[model samples]
Target: MCGIVGYVGKRDALPIVVEALRRMEYRGYDSAGVAIVDDSGHLMVDKRAGRLENLDAALAAHPAGSFAGTTGMGHTRWATHGRPTDRNAHPHVSADGKAAVVHNGIIENFAPLRAEVEAAGIEFSSDTDTETAVHLLALEYDGGEHAGDFIGSAYAVLRRLEGAFTLVFTHADHPGTIVAARRSTPLVVGVGDGEMFVGSDVAAFIEHTRDAVELGQDQVVVITADDYTITDFDGVSQQGKPFHIDWDLAAAEKGGHDFFMLKEIAEQPQALADTLLGHFENGRVVLDEQRLSDGDLREIDKVFVVACGTAYHAGMLAKYAIEHWTRVPVEVELASEFRYRDPVLDRSTLVVAISQSGETADTLEAVRHAKEQKALVLAICNTNGAQIPREADAVLYTHAGPEIGVASTKCFLAQIAATYLVGLALAQARGTKYPDEVAREYADLERMPDAVAEVLKTGPAVRDLAQSLADVNTVLFVGRHVGYPVALEGALKLKELAYIHAEGFAAGELKHGPIALLEDDLTVIVIMPSPSGRAVLHSKMVSNIREIQARGARTIVIAESGDDAVRPLADHLIEIPQCSTLLQPLVSTVPLQIFAAALAQSRGYDVDKPRNLAKSVTVE
Candidate 1:
């Protein structure tokens, strides 16, 4: 899950490449590096083994003053093929220093390839599979050929290797060109005036231009100082479809916040508002696209929500609403393991695949498998025109805009909001809930942005609590029903941000195993269900809180403003705005996000760029 950014443009390549790497910091990199072609046909490489700030300090120390040829490439690496050392950092160079390559995704067959290269008398310096690619390109360039021919050779070499990858490289000999290719991973090309850019995604070049071209599977792109050409792996020329990006570069910036996570936490109001826009009118929910007819939706007898990580938590939240509103059973499955188990899905089953980026390999594969089984596939995604959305039978797009942080923030809220709308649509179509009842739910959803805003005002308290517990080694979260998923999300955020041991469990399951972990020193965050809506769940959770509190755990209760039942057991209480039980996740999740971000910041870790994590999981 590394980040790759490249440019073939007229400006000084050093600053642009470095800035792009900084923008990509949220994608989780253990090391950062850049390689720029100089005016004298030399590839200038600079890299460090720490965060991007370390690389930035190095750049400042040795100011590669206006290092000027137009072609360059950069990488922020998450160590997988090698350790997090300077020698293992990306922008791997050829032995002769003629070519420098940056890559994302794993090369599964690199061991055999490396053995063959070593047998051929090539010496390797780093342990990364990416280095093999650079060596192969060097061998290809050893032949006297044009840049395009060498790119074709490189493509052929890549074709022989197994696994997923998106690679970009530039040779010193080809001073004004950068060659790139992708397979089972994402790579986008940004077009600008008199310049060209390539990145693992659009966020890399969103600052320069909003126009981008999505590279197709097994396509190689040859970019020059003034032109770019796309071709298939076999060298036949192909046309690349270009799309316009709607988000401006400002969205990627921190906007004076301490970190991207905190900034995103504050942006939730606008994000929720944007997601809610155009979704409801006259007591009916509307989707971005209606490919599935009412007959198609009504004929569906079962539902499967497939996702991974935070998206899986969203799916869990969706399951509750879908079942409650439509009177249909819904199952949530991790996409990576969904197809392997041979689930008994059929024509009557509807597979709802959720992903922020539609490029999640396992999720996309699961969606494909479901379609093969003749299941109607629906994709809920934030990104437009991504692979899963394009391939699915129907799509519900979450208009939360760009979420850059590796650990999700606004996307979680957007996903829950989208899923709620989808549930309402299903209930409306199936005649399960009354029209006025649906309208009331819609009205509750309309108030969510403000509720989110109110929850965000708890930032100061959360920050204080985070600072107090920054040194704690472990945290436990417990919730019932919808809060259970919120607990899962809470634990995930803490693990991602704080690098601490955390676990989330259903409160009902606490006495079974997890309550034993509760001690006088341990921190327990309980999401108290809304007492106004469901008395049973609310009372059960309160009793659960008292159980843990009696066991000497320091209880931090997140309860609705008017819920006084949990107050007696709460050592610390965080109050959220009053909301419907089903919609509480949209409010409860906000405080946990703030708490995690503040804790990471207090620990001196980068809240936006946590260790060993990336914003997008492009590889399986």
Candidate 2:
């Protein structure tokens, strides 16, 4: 995963590109660099192997007049090919120093390309798959059928490259132009009067223009100061899909919160509302892109939910809801392991792929695998114009805007809402739920925003609880049904943000192994089922809490406001508004998010950018 920004505008490119990199730094923070064609028409690159601030300090140490250009590109790298060092930073230059390139994904054929270029007496200065691209471009431009053509040489090199990647190239001689292309990885163009922009995503140029063009797979783009052109690798012209970004720059900002994670956690109510809006129309549940007919959905005999990390936890909930509502056999698999298992799939199988950023490598591959087996794929994503949605037979957008925090918050809730919508849609299509019943379920879902908002009121109490357990070396979470996934997600958040050992178990499995970890003062977080809706689960959870408490463990139970049995059992009771069993995670998850962020703050850890993690996983 990496962030890339390329601009050819009338204004100074340095500040614009640098600010864009700052906004996209959530994508990657291993290293930072910028390539600008100075006023003298010479390529100038400055990079450092650390955070963007390290590159900022390097730039500040130099005189302001040292670098100036109207055409430039910038990169913030999450190193994959080599170690995070200066030599492995992006904006890698050619041996001839005429071409500079910055790239986002892995190059599957870089080894052979590197060997071929080396045989031609080109010694690489850095150990990066991206370095081979610049060398190949220089070689192609210096002498070939397309000699003296910048775009032609760039396309020639791109045609030979392999794997998922977004690449931007600049030549010192062509200061007014930049060449960019993408295959599998994301790339977009920003339209502005008297200017043009290209980047890995809209956030790179959102400050200047919301009119964005999303490039399709294997497409190349050439951006000049005043216009842009899109084409295939063979030089055939193509049109990009244009769309407007609804939210402004303020949405991406912290909004006075100490960290983006805290602000995102607080935005869950609105995010859930936005995701559920317009999904229920004409007394029917609708998806955003429904290329498949209702007949196709009704014919589906098996369902698979594939995802990774937080999205995978959301998939676990999807499996529970889909099977319960539609009576279809549903299986949830880790995307990385889905294809390898040779899962039995066919035209009757429905593969639901969930990803916040549609470009997640493993999920994308899983989608491809399912498609290869003739399974219809539906993507539930937060991002528009991303690869997974583009490739899916249908899509249900989460509408979570942008999640800048490396550890997801609002997006996870939005995804859960999307999954429920999918379940309802399938149930309706299969005639499992009556039309009036579907409408009633949707009306209940529409009430969840208020429930989530009510849950936010418990933040101060959750913060206090988190502080009390901040010094504890271990924390365990337990729940049944949908609450079990919330427990897993809560444990994941603590482990991600607090850097401590945590685990989540099904309430019934505590005695199997996890109960052995309990000791005096050990903290165990419990997600209580709504007693009115699932009295059996609620009673079982109470018994589980009592058992943990008897073993000298301190319990923090998230339960409904009127659940008196669990209220007395919990050492610290975090009450949430009562909701249906299927929708409880929307509220139960909020406190755990607050707890994790607050706990990490108490431990003096960065709550937004967890170490060794990127916002999007573009590399497998």
Candidate 3:
């Protein structure tokens, strides 16, 4: 994944685009660059390896150029095709300096295209697939019927390309215009008075304009200072669906926090509340967008959930709830491995896809495959107008606002809340639960925001415990029933932020194999179920705690508010608010997040931007 921004506006393009890139830096930060069409019809370009600050320093040192040009584009890369280097940075320009291009996503046929261009006796500059696009554009503009036609040349180049990409082009001859197109990647056009903008997401130009036009697949857009036009690749006129961003610019900024991760963690309460708001009307649960009718939901025989990373963990939780409520068989599959398995499907099957960005490469492809097999597809997503939701038969928006943290916190919780609503809706549609039972479930959900807030009160204690164990070589987490996914999520957070060796196992499976890894003073965190409900699970967990403690392992137990049975057994106890058996994840997951952040910060790591990771996975 990479961040891209383009501007054809009255304001200075360089600063505007650079600031937008800063907002989207969580997307990618391997390298940064910009290309601009100056006022005198000249192309000015600069790039630097490493973070955006490196490019900023280069711009500061060479401040005499035409960075003030009103037509420009910028890119912060994630480095898929080549190493992170100055020459490999984006905004790859033509040799004659007449055309420039920036791109996101992969070009699968780039090798053949590069060979063909090189066969024409044109030398190449860098080891990036994006450079081939610029060279082809320059060649198309140099001669032939498309000669001197900038948009026409861009169209010609786009028609020859295969694979997913979002390309924005600028030509020195076309001073005030920008041509942009998308095949499968994300590209949005922001409509502003006397100006226009294009970026990977609304966060790029949200400060200047909230009105945005979301382009469909295989569409092209031409933007000038005062107007914009949309068309298909074959030159047929088309219109992009427009929507206003509900959150403002301030939501994208970290307000007096050490990092965006910390801010997002603190915002979890509001995130969950907002996701649950307006979901219940007229004593029934509803979805954000429901193209599938009630009869369609009732006819479902099997359910499949496809997702990756934290979203996959949310899907695992959804499996438990959906099956329990609707009595339907649910299967959770990793999106990367879904289609390859050649799963059984039909019109009666319902496929649920979960993704925070909704552009996750594997999950989007899985959704496409499910739709091709004539299965009804429903999507759970955070970002509005994202590709997966746009292609699905129905969608449920998480309403978590902008999650800028690379390691998700608020969005993960919001996904759980939204999935719970989906479960209730399915149960209602299938007549599996009475209307009064569904209302009670919704009421219990409404009280979870406060329960989550209560869990935040224990952050100080969790941080203290985490700091003491920051030097440990390995940590193990164990849970049972619904807590199994929470344990897995905890281990994932630790591995993502702290870069430590961590593993999660079912509490009952300690003796199976994971128990051998336990040694003297090794830390083991156990998520204890509620003693009031499922006494069997709580007792079994206590036995697992004892098994680990007998091996001289240190214990940090997360239990309900008053669990006296574990008082004498736990070396360190962290309490969370009591909730229903299935709803425990909503509260149990908070302390683990706090503990992971504090532990990573204690080790002097940047929790916001972990090494070798980007916020979104746009490439497979």
Candidate 4:
């Protein structure tokens, strides 16, 4: 999956598409290009092998955006089936230059399709599966069977593709419209006054209008300046679900922060508050979009939380709370590996799927697999009307609007807050907790936004510590209980942003193996338990810190305020407000994010768009 932009309107397509592609550069940064249809019926595609700026330079010498038409498509490819070279950059053009295509998602059967097309005397120019689709569309448009019907030709081309893809194309013969199709990856239509837009996400078009229609699976859309028509691959008409984006264009901007990461970090408190808003009714936790009834929740005996990457860490944190509150056996599984394991499932099983972009390929496939076995699927997502939420039995949306940073900041905390809501709702349904107890926990959760805000205020110290450790070759994170997942997430952020070798270990498992790597010059971050309560855990963690410090590892402790035991052993001590055992993750995780971002910046890396990573993993 990558960035996709298509516009058919009265505005100049070049400047509009270039600006939109810049907005979506976080989606893919390997290469950027655009294909525009000029007034003289020329299909012009100018792309380069570097960042969007490279394409900007390429367009400078030969401006395709200055063409005399307002219909075009742009793409920023994150190399899937080819290398990041000039030849492999999109928009992949047909040999005749009659058609061009920009694509997201993997075309799994492109090899066989390439073979078929080659046998028919169609030569390929680029080493991309995207090229094969463009050639196939040209053939369909020029063939004896479906000649001269761009929309029908697009429908035919889509029916032959084997894997998930969102395709938007331009035809020189039909400069007034663009044909787009989707199978699994994201594609949405932006409806405006006298024009329409298509994008991989709503952010691409939010600046123009908030009126968006989310395209469903296996649907094709034909759009012009005035109107759009949605149809199935088989030519059956369908209507897409329309929704308004709650956030304005400013949410996707950096807002004068040094980086989008920093801005998103500062937005976490408000994000947490929004996620927990209006989730209570009549002293019991309420869910607005629940299709699974209280009777269904009461009958659930097992829960499986499935996700990938940072979301997988959120799922790990959710497992602890779900099992503790509902007394149901909970299992955390990597979404990419969940379906392959042949796990048993039944009506009594509840699968909780977490994804910041609900379009994550592995998690979406996992949800489908679970539903096939008669399991109830619940989605915790940020994007409204995303496929995972629309397909699941129920959904709880984390209203963290438009996290543009490649590394998750606000969404991670919001997800944790949502998980807390999920646990409370389950407990209320199962009679696992008294109503007063549930109310108290709910109130505590509501107040966590302030605690998170307090932690955000303490970010400068972590940034300072990170600047000191910029030259450190390796780092390690250790924790107990909920902090364990927080450690893993912290380590992951370090590796993703700082490009360092980092690992997270359970603090109690030190002697087994992780401690052997504790030598001089290596930094270890220990997330300590709250000392006010859980005294036993606090004592054990303090012992773990001392052991690591004794081993010559410089230890950084994330401890609670007024906790004095860790002060003597810690090389750097960061304090957070004391909260309940499970909720410590909300505050304890903040500094790690700040530190990772600062360290990456000190190393001269782009914290907003890390190398070789996309904002959304839309391909499996």
> What's the CA RMSD of model 3 in angstroms?
1.1
Q: How well does candidate 1 score on lDDT at residue 139?
A: 74
lDDT for each residue of candidate 1 in 481-554, tens digit (9 for 90 to 100): 99999999999999999999999999999989887787886799999999998899988987898788788889
TM-score result, candidate 3: 0.99
Tens digits of per-residue lDDT for model 3, 448-532:
9899999999988899989988898799999999999999999999999999998888899999989998889999989999998
Better of 1 and 4 by TM-score: 4
Residues 94-136, candidate 4: write the lDDT tens digits: 8798899999988999999899889889889888999999998
Q: What is the lDDT of candidate 1?
A: 0.87
TM-score for candidate 2, residues paired by index: 0.99
Question: Which pairs of residues collide in model 3?
Answer: none
Error of 4 at 330 (Å): 0.6
Error of 4 at 178 (Å): 0.4
Please, what are the lDDT tens digits per residue for candidate 2 over residues 1-620? 69999999788889999999999987857999999897568888899998888999998888876768898999999989999999999899998888999999999999999999999999999989999999999999998777889889999999999988999999998898999999999999999888999988888998899898999999999999888999998999999998998878998899999999999988888999999999877779998978888999999999999999999999999888899999999999999999999999999999999999999999999999999999999999999989999999999999888899999999999999999999999999999999998998899999999999999999998899889777888999999999999999999999999999999899999999888888889989999999898788877888898899999998888989988877778788899998889999989999999999999999999998999999899989
- lDDT score, candidate 2: 0.92
Give stretches of model 4 more than 4 Å off: 63-66
lDDT of 1 at 253: 78
By lDDT, the better pick of 3 and 4 is 3
- TM-score per model over all chains: 0.93, 0.99, 0.99, 0.98
